[model samples]
Target: MSRNIPLLDLQKEFEMLKPELMPALEEVLSSARFIMGPQLDELNDHIQSLLGVKHHIPCANGTDALLIALKALDIQPGDEVITTPFTFVATAETIAFAGAVPVFTDIRSDTCLMDPNLIEERITEKTKAIIPVHLFGQMVPMEPVMTIAKKYGLKVIEDTAQAIGATQHGCFAGTIGDIGTISYFPSKNLGAYGDAGGIVTNNDSLAETCALIANHGQAHKYEHHLIGLNSRMDSLQAAILNVKIKYLEEWNILRAEKAAWYHKYLDPSVETPVTVPGNTHIYHQYTIKVDQRDALKEYLAGQGIATAVHYPIPLNEQPAIAALKLHGFPTPVAAKTAQRVLSLPMNQYLSEEDIRYVADAVNSFLNTKKSQSFQNSPTGSSV
Candidate 1:
């Protein structure tokens, strides 16, 4: 019988780390450090040293990280924050959550990142920030985004939920902007056992503000500085992250190896992900653009292979965003990619054999459709 392949099999990874994780979790329980404690401090130090950032403020989730970053930057009501609509809802939702308008920008057709060329036309006097999402494990070409931001005097927030350790032109994914937000949800490249997040910045004042906003605006005990929310990552999640952080670089390398296998084995018909110049993709999702994405996903499921669509709908087209009554620029590329992008099974533990199986499944499906007229699919794969 064929084996069942999950989109991400964290259970195997968990089992591998069981010994270290158990002792760490037990220590937190025994010390009764359920909330902020030594564990969080250690994790922060670990991340700070690795990323070479001035501060790493722990938070409850990635959404809170973005919201706190926005609040710290003083994005006021009616202020516009530009971001790509092709990303997860959290990216734009956090802007609206911070009482700022989410101005949608179109994405690059090849890489699906926010197009810097389209950004200038969207900026207005009300624009305060630009959020470039590092989607599917590759950093957006941040040089142009930063240049445009500096030209417009707009703050920048890097949404690095998927591309934690990814780099563009030697700068880490989260370090290029004014502030960077990370997600430690279990599925991330550097995931915790549950919900967790952190903020990274080189500026001292912004770091202090983010820390305060994430902790109910407390400057000191019983002293309120600004209106803030209670959003701190717990000790248990921190403890889990402590053990996992050491292996992050190794795991990302392994994931890249798995992606290579797919690239080598997939048939010529399917379009593979494109990694831009001077960028390292961690392959967080290994998304490919195909004509019949839903059909391929269904066919793979029947073969005990799991696949996922990173975002089936652009945020600007969603009803919740529509309810906000916000006017968004046209995002035809985002809308077009949303229907074609399919995330194949990608994880550190995926073997070459597993990749071949998935590629074969994809090729078989495409072969079934080969007789029909094909369009808009990039080529360059050989099985």
Candidate 2:
């Protein structure tokens, strides 16, 4: 029997949470206080408690959270912020939008994380901060990154968009850095009903500045103190996220279990995700690296299985940033990785049977490719 598996299915998640979510939505609709309602405060409190942070500033989306954090840190024109080129463009886009140059850095081949070894060489007098992204629900080696930041007096902003409940050595992803950002874009580990995000910080001054900036730079209503954007979290989205946060840890566990199933069953010739020591990976996307990535993706589609590429191009090669005329740094690993990475179907709702099926399909395709290659060899002969 042919099975249809999607990369991610939000409908199943919604049906499971409908019992608890409907009332929350009804309560918000009844109150008629759509924007900046009580739900936002409730959600903020829950997130702050979850991450053990002092303050949580809710915003409209993840991109805004990054921008707000950079602006609050006073990143001025010509300043440089270091980050990896392998991640989503928003990581570098926010830096450029904040009037700072995003210094691209290479990544490690094993973990696909920003190489802490390569960061210091890019530092200059104008380098003001480091934005280490926890790509695909895994933590960057923060101990050394933090050490470097301390030596250079550079601020650290963690882009924890894909990793919410992940931890390294018992320290949470967003809590380790000076400022951290999370996304609730309906596809995140702790997704909301719509676009939503939050900023986390232990620094009282930075927290206050970010909150003010998110609320139109106001010290009081209609009193603008500094230039800022109007980026507030919607009350309805907050209500949805408040409910979803309760299950985030459990969902992450299930995701990890699913990833393990893949690790056990996948072909040994393919490369699987690597988890750093003492770190808890939430498995936002169970991505695998294989040769003939595009052909394999097409083969999977024919078998009624869905797949996706997390990123098909490195940030430095993107046309959108071409106008910035940024200097190019050698990111050979990231450049090579973009061509071979493929994300498999992953969700808490998936069963063991489903995982096995996906693995079987992938192996069947890989085996076929191997057989074809051997037959095409010059020394090959029919058995």
Candidate 3:
């Protein structure tokens, strides 16, 4: 069977927003201001207003956003920043890029967020910050994390790349931390047409520093202050994002509705995603846990269903970063969870029929596996 359900359908999303997208692009082209244009300023203003943050600095991409946030905080060589191992490499890569060591912490078994209970044990005299990723569109348990940070005077940077509109107990995901970073990658909840990102902070000085860092540390047109990277969002991407921002809340609601549909139809034998209490999950990816994950993924694919592993290998185990020589962190929970987690098709554009079909396919695969296991038992012949 040909593959039917996909992980995401950006084409359908574009079709829904074409009416506004075309005019926005045309406006940018006519103005001829592609860099640092009016659209960029408008997007920054809109993001600040939406998140109720004091400053919103747009950057080239999500990775750059994290790097800029770290630079703004003055995290440097010999400093250690604690973060979860079960996340996209960018979460830890940016820390190392900022000339700091990324100390790994295990995630909670249920929520898949960094375990706050294990954090204090990892802090040392060189610890400067803690980066808690809002994984799979749910906010990390910030209350406990924040308390721990306060006790040790460590700064917090919320990696909100996946959880743009998520909230916890009335606090927005990114806004709760000292510095918050968002990604506008094509797949994110609030994605632009291409690579783009933003940095958010309530602190006036940090905000100024972030803007300077993203703009090559330029105090003026020709004068350079601090060494920085060239990371800026172009006018076209900013214009596209401006149009999409108006529909972000509604799309998130649709994603939630689809998640509910998945919950209603999927077999109870498999594990479904658990929303952290007091959190509004945007369902960037409707991930589930199941035994025999690799075999089940192949089974689903053969039945025309698409599945993905968000992170098959934890950051600490990736060979590419072996030069960091990180070791001795107890991350049993992260290591175990990485082997079993599977992401099903999830997006605002999915239909009820699409959700039902995917769930039915998964159920069929699991049922077959169970039958095979029972038949292979030693006592099967007697029965």
Model 3 TM-score is 0.98
Q: Write the per-residue lDDT of candidate 1 for residues 1-383, one digit (tens) a residue.
A: 56699999899999999999999999999999798889999999998887878889999999999999999999999999999999999998989887899999899988998888999999999999999999999988888999999999999999988888898877888998999999999999899998999999999999999999989999999899989899989999999999999999999899999989999999866788889899999998999999889988998999999989989999999999989988757899999999999999998888899999999988988887773434333442221
lDDT of each: 0.91, 0.92, 0.91
Q: Candidate 1 — which residues are off by over 4 angstroms?
A: 372-383
Name the TM-score of candidate 1: 0.96
User: What residue pairs are clashing in model 1?
Assistant: none
State model 3's lDDT. Answer: 0.91
Worst 10 residues of 3 by lDDT: 319-328
For model 3, the superposed segments whose C-alpha errors exceed 4 Å read 1-3
Model 2 worst lDDT window (10 residues): 374-383
lDDT of 2 at 231: 95
Write the residue-wise lDDT of candidate 2 on 1-383 in tens digits.
88999888899999999999999999999999899999999998998999889999999999999999999999998999999998989999999998899999999888888889999999999999999999999999899999999999999999999999999999899899899999989989999878899999999999999999999999988999889898999999999998988999999999999999999889888799999898899998888988799999998998888999988999998997767889888899999999989999999988888889999999999999998888888765554
Residues 1-383 of candidate 3 have per-residue lDDT tens digits of 34488898899989989999999999999999999999988998899888888889999999999999998898998799999999999999999887899999999888888988999999999999999999999999899999999999999999999999899998888998899999999999899888999999999999889999998999899788888889989999999999999999999999999999999999999799999889999999899999899998998888778889988998888885567987558799899999999999998878898898889888988998888888888776557
Top candidate (lDDT): 2
